[model samples]
Target: MTVLTKPWIWSCVAAAVAYALILGLTSGRGAGELAYAALSFGAFAAIVGLGQMLVITLGPGNVDLSVPATMTLAATLALKAMGTDPGTAMLGLVIALFVGFGVGIANYALIYFLRLPPIIATLAASLVYQSLAIWSNRGLRIKPPSGLADFATGRFLGLPNVAWVGLFLAIVVWVVLERSVWGRWLLATGQNMRAARLAGVPVELVRALTYISVAVFSALTGYLLASFSGGAALNMGAEYLLMSIAVVVVGGSSIAGGNSNVPGVWGAALFMFLVVSMLNSYGAGAGVRNVLTGTIIIGIVIAASTRRVRA
Candidate 1:
């Protein structure tokens, strides 16, 4: 079918297939439980993936490598700020968002003023961010406030609270990118920065804002994760660095830039988690899982690229 040709559709299909495979290995209500787990974990990936997709839409050679560091540092400071106070959820959230803002501005400043490539700037900044997190965390685990923890881990209408947050962000982002004037400017800028500038688009401002937005998104994920997991570990966001970019690419967002799809990101996020679960059920080792996952990603990229070429 024509619709099946959509790149994003594949992730959804894969997720379904993975779910079936897992179900085949078990009986009873395991299916529902597995699905719930997938949604709960996938939400984090989807949230960060949406942010990465925005920055990536800005064009090639543009990506935020500091997501994990941003997450770690923000969560560290936020948890520390709340200090397990009973009603300090908002305080912690604001602290986390503030940290994200600073990191975003710092990343852009490095790129704009120092003329550094995004990869280099974000990577360099990540080292500093990570150091800060280490110093602030001091190899200790700080618990999230009780209410915030419950809200993070709680469920709503048979779906995870975190999943609801992810869905909400996805909706907002989809609306902004698909319907707003600023979205048009972002797309135009991504398509051709020089042309966009000549046409009166504020390219510089767009870049700054995009960078900032990605960091803020990452920070939010970090805060929720710290709460959900009970504490923010120094390496809490390490795996998400790859997961963020992976979901973007797998969800049909163009790696080259100027194109994105939000539904695909969520689908891809679910698929990612399901695939790991399937592998685990089949007794695959971590190394084997990594190899297989990498292979799958490479194959998908090649297939997508060939299709684009044919089109």
Candidate 2:
């Protein structure tokens, strides 16, 4: 496909233009500042969307519903472990990743061994992770390391360091999904699992590793978010679950699987965040904002379904 026909490129351009117009009409004084803020905040959603994209690409009806819980638990654990020591902070980050890895293993076992559907298995896993996060939060005081906080909030070339991290992750994921042998195997598996299996494509292992990779991504996002916010909270990752799925779908990824648009995920993330920002600038309440967001998501899903039918 030509560059201009790529959904990611157009979606990004549309988002940027729409954001500028909204800022000009509503606020009229801080377009640049608001743009920067939107991009910075949207980076978190983009990162999570990337993980969701990976899972969804596994096949139709596959999704990782445990992302929010994994992120929250990782953040809580990291905060408690850091406690003001630099060395301890790194160790804490590692420990949080390990926690997420453990959850991935559980998810794999439930789905692979029990023949459970991915959605139900992940939902059950989410409950476990959420319970653990809540239990960990009891009577705990959180103070994120100053160094980590600084890095998260710091700016380079007018963008936050967190945004840079998101960009780097996007590059990595794009390369893996578009330019590597593993990418071909994953696409083949998603396209036709039976065919892939017959061709010796290790479908089971690929699906299992996809879950683990998503968990790691979630854990990393949690750490970045906690550091950016200077602390952790139970609700920090709550909004991400729907947002990630929405971003992936709106970014032109096939709900049926076998196709992914890496850059489109980034654009869709920006678009969603910009919509929220614009509504807030217009003094819209949370209820109205959510309603609008939901409506947009429904529209996108319908469009995607229609496109698939036509194809």
Candidate 3:
């Protein structure tokens, strides 16, 4: 299919148009400010969405339910590691990465060795991570470092640096998916795991690596979010779980795997943030927002699934 005809591309265009319309109708002259805020906040969702994209590309019925828990744990651990020393924040970053790796290992063991379904395995892992997060948060309160917070909230060249980070990550994933042999292997494995194994694709290894990559991305996102918000909370990452999946699905990544739309995920993330921001501006309550968001996601998922069936 031509790029223009790709469902993901069209979904992105539609999202942009919807955002513009919402701004014109609601914000008037303040649209730019709202847009900037949305993009800044949306960067976190976009980053997490990339991770979700990788995992979902592993095939049908695959998802990472541990994302929110991983994010929460990373944020809390980072705050603990960064205590009273801005220069030592690297320690926190490293710790977050390590935690993510450990989580990935656990997930791999559960799915690969225990032979659990991906969803059930990840769901169970998520509970363990959540418990860790809760345990870590107990009697621990630390301020995020000034430098990290500044970097997260600062503007470089009139754009949020976090947004730039998100863009860079997307580019890296795009290159891996489009220009590298590993990308080909990943797609092939997703398309037909048994066939890929027969063809010497190392299916198990690819799946394992994908899980690790997703965990690392989730950890990074958690750090950035904590820095942006100036502190970490037990529920800080709860919202991201659904948002990450929604962006990937809305961006045209196949639920059945074997395909991904990297650029589209970014647009979908921004669109989701805009919708939430607009609703907030209109004073919509949390319940209303949740219902609306859920309805929209369901619609998009149904449409994507239908298209896949038709194809």
Q: Which residue runs does candidate 3 get wrong by more than 4 Å?
A: 1-3, 283-291, 298-311
Candidate 2 residue-wise lDDT, 163-278, digit = tens: 89899999999999999988777888888899989999989999998888888888888888988887888888899999889888888887778888899888888888888777
Clashing pairs in 2: none
What are the per-residue Cα lDDT tens digits for candidate 3 across 1-311?
Answer: 55555657645665676577677676566777876886798899999999999999989878899999898888888888788477767888898888888888889889999999989999999998889887876836577888888888998888899999999999999999999989999999889999999999989999999999888899899888888887778888889988899899888888789998898798888878877766676678999998987776677666655665566
Tens digit per residue, CA lDDT, model 1, 1-311 = 47756777767777888889888888534877888899999999999999999999999999999999999999999999999999999999999999999999999999999999999999999999999999986948899999999999999999999999999999999999999988888888888899999999999999999999999999999999999999999999999999999999988888888888888899989989999998999899999999988887777666655665565
**Every candidate's lDDT:** 0.91, 0.84, 0.84
- Residue 271 in model 3: lDDT: 77
CA lDDT for candidate 1? 0.91
- What is the Å distance of residue 275 in model 2 from its true position? 0.2
Q: Whole-model lDDT for model 3 versus the true structure?
A: 0.84
* Model 2 residue 1 CA deviation in Å: 3.5
lDDT of 2 at 227: 84
Q: How many clashes does each candidate structure show, in the order listed?
A: 0, 0, 0
Give the higher-TM-score candidate: 1 or 3.
Answer: 1
User: After best superposition, candidate 2 residue 66: deviation in angstroms?
Assistant: 0.5
The superposed Cα distance between candidate 2 and the true structure at residue 108, in angstroms, equals 1.0
